[model samples]
Target: MTQSKEIKKPSSGLAARIFRQQMFIPLAALFLLALFNFIMDPSFYRISFDYNSVGNPVLSGNIISILDAGSELAILAIGMTLVTAATGGQDISVGAAIAISGSVVLRVLCGTNSRPDTLQAPIFVAILVSCVVAMLFGAFNGMLVAYFRIQPMVATLILFTAGRSIAAWINNNELPIISDPSFGVFGGFIPGIPIPTPIFIAAGCMIVIALVLRFTNLGLYVQSVGINESSSRLNGLNPAFIKFLTFVVLGLCVAVAGLIKVSRFSSINYSVVAKDIEMDAILAVALGGNALSGGKFNMKASIIGAYVIQFLATTLYKFKVQSTALPAYKAVVVILLVVLSAPKVREYLARIGKQIRQKTHVKEAG
Candidate 1:
């Protein structure tokens, strides 16, 4: 069973050339950010010793804050990546999911009506309940996007419309105080690393998802359906079921993001929480180089994009600039990055380019 094979290389490889040219934009952006930050604040680069000197393991320093914030984004991005790549859909409801899912956690575990003595239950109960409810929300999204054949964009719209409103309704539109000591653990830093607990959870989630997508049969099925559902179906794949599974996963992700939001705020908000979160996931997936039309999946790239977006925001905040303008600026930057990272259009253009070159050569020799 030991067969030797030669490594193959295409004669006309343009990928190397193109990737080099395209990398300039992201590179330049990072360079400029570093330059700007370095010129202004010398202390910005000083890594804090807060991680080791912390009393509460979670809220030690900026390192964990960034990770805590990233957990919400990371959770959302994983689902968004799945939706966009494997399920052939997108959801604007995740922002709503953040609110709805977290509201469920707060209300179920620490509702105002609960006996004051039992308001603070073990954190595990709230965590488990939040995850289950989140899956339900994701399943709801799957029913629309996968089973009904509704446009993925429109299908998740149902959640987009009323998800946050309902989340707000649960808490009477005010932030509910969570009194659970165990659940409160999530808001603190780890003993060693300055990283927040939420970040560790998010990192764990990323690892799990990445493993699932790589080793299991689900991975093959996902790429198959995303590449060509018709072909995969002819080959005995259940495209509908696979797609449904993915949306359910998406729901779980939204729920996780909502959980992170809750942990970050230590409460629940219906009116203001998780507003416009779908955009963050979309940007992360897009920037990660995942195809908009669906094909290869890049979980690592998506994580990087999430970090980049967060850092961009951090940079702006550290400079005392009006943060309100960030959304628009980030969007513009992302759109351009998407345009540059796009592989398909460039392939098509390259094909046409070859044809024209052949024709021109023929005319010159003729």
Candidate 2:
């Protein structure tokens, strides 16, 4: 008789996958909050279609609105994920960078004085100029962090403090408007489409990032540098170059997000274009279960975290909570999730579980 070896079946369950990916806490919190909202108001999950004042078909519902409004944050989180992974630092100047980019768009659309003559500027020109300027700004930050070895926060803070003021100078302190119906298509919806265009833009950006990371060594290099810069250098990877490129890519994200924001209103306001959004983007990256100390990262988790933050804020608003108090509510939920996901807490739980199993096994044996 021949001896046979037994093969075990692979575990493929939702719980197993969640645990394996370390996403159990975030996913569980997401579902719990969603269920709570649904229980409080059965209509919370309901979606309905309607027409806007312009006679275009539109999606009208809380969930739709949340995704639509959260697109910018989602986009920013993608860029933030890369920067955090490569440089082990978050860009706090994203809002300012976008403000500057939006202002560049405005200057292109309406010129220095924001006159109708400037409206003749081609939309492509405006977009291109904005992207270039944003990239330059990003490169500036990258130079400081990569070449000068300055702290990422301190390097970016320079732009953060002066960005809007620079925007004011760019437009000569006058608001610039695109004044084209076509411009609204990017911010709102295409003709005859019920979905918001920003959603598609965000999705497209995400797909591009995923493809780039999937098909190239860029992701590997980033993580390697993040984990150990000296080791990466020894392996022929240029950490400085990688870090610089990360910021440049993030600049692209800021440009795209700024375009959508300005397109939404067809104008740029230097004072409030992307104010305070940097904090939210950073929070999204952190909440996505990425270590702020760098090393490994998951863009998908950051994306989910972006949606979670938006959903939490939306739900809070639905519950009649004051707008000012929404941040506090978010803090409570985020704190709970973080605590539950802490390594120490998980290890303690595992110890207790093992003890229970041991006791049960002993009793069964007896």
Candidate 3:
């Protein structure tokens, strides 16, 4: 009986430790949000849905928008996570890639001279073309980084600035409207609920990526190469090939996210569609509990980070204390949140908590 108890105790402790490290930050953030909202307004728990309104009532009252914000983060962070893991690098041109994706779709489907109703292409073909363009761009970055050993930032930086210019050149820096029935799937809504098509697309991407990384030997190869390229190569894993592949996938993700952005706005402004979106992607990856050094990547954690960021933004706007300084406020909160969210820090607290409990029990016995 004693031996069984001991085994179970250790297992339980290990599980608790794991949950605390992974879940604490997101849960605490949500708790703080609830407490703050409750303190500010007693009816913070209020929830409602009205589907019968004539001019189209929101299905879940913007819940889809919150998820949509997270979806953008998920797509960008997928690339960031892979690159950071494989090559020990960060791709700063994430936003630029996204701009190119949206711009290409708009220009091809809805040219500046053409109305939103102009061009009609199959969705799969459009997506495939965008993915190819994104892959070429990402491959360009990989060549520089892998062959010349350039800083990942600098290598991607070349495209980061130039890519936007190229997108603007295509669009004449104007917003192009999207009216194809195929494109409309992205923003379609069921009577009571606004189904953000982008959100579903993003979810599909997450499923595909998760499936790829979880069930394949390729996942093992990338992780081994990420931890140590030389050893992985000696063991016959090709680091160069993995890095190249990761960037290509990253670019594809950026491209899809861009398409969604354009769809959401119903137009593409080459300049405005993806400004500073790279920051959101990076922050999402970090907030998802990834280390700056990289080795492990967690899709679910990243997804949560995306949602958390959006949640914070929405919570702020809902309070109506809106101001331009909100970004600054968000920055500060994120910094603090990130610090507290560290796995090491969470472990330390759990240790202290266990010690304190032991002492309290001893005192009671005495």
Task: Tell me, by TM-score, which candidate is best.
Answer: 2
Ranking by TM-score: 2, 3, 1
lDDT of 1 by residue, 4-29 (tens): 11122232344435454523444455
Q: Locate the minimum summed-lDDT window of 10 residues in model 2.
A: 1-10
TM-score-better candidate, 1 vs 2: 2
> Global lDDT for candidate 2?
0.85
Best lDDT among the predictions, by candidate number? 2
TM-score, every prediction = 0.81, 0.92, 0.84
- In model 2, what are the clashing residue pairs, if there are any? none
When summed lDDT is taken over every stretch of 10 residues in candidate 1, the lowest stretch is 1-10
Q: How well is each residue in 44-112 modelled by candidate 2, as lDDT tens digits? A: 988999999999999889889889888999999998989999999989999999889988887877764
Q: Which wins on lDDT, candidate 1 or candidate 3?
A: 3
Residues 280-321, model 3: lDDT tens digits = 777776777766565666667776777777777777777774
**What does candidate 3 score on TM?**
0.84
Q: TM-score for candidate 2, please give it.
A: 0.92
Candidate numbers, best lDDT first, in rank order? 2, 3, 1
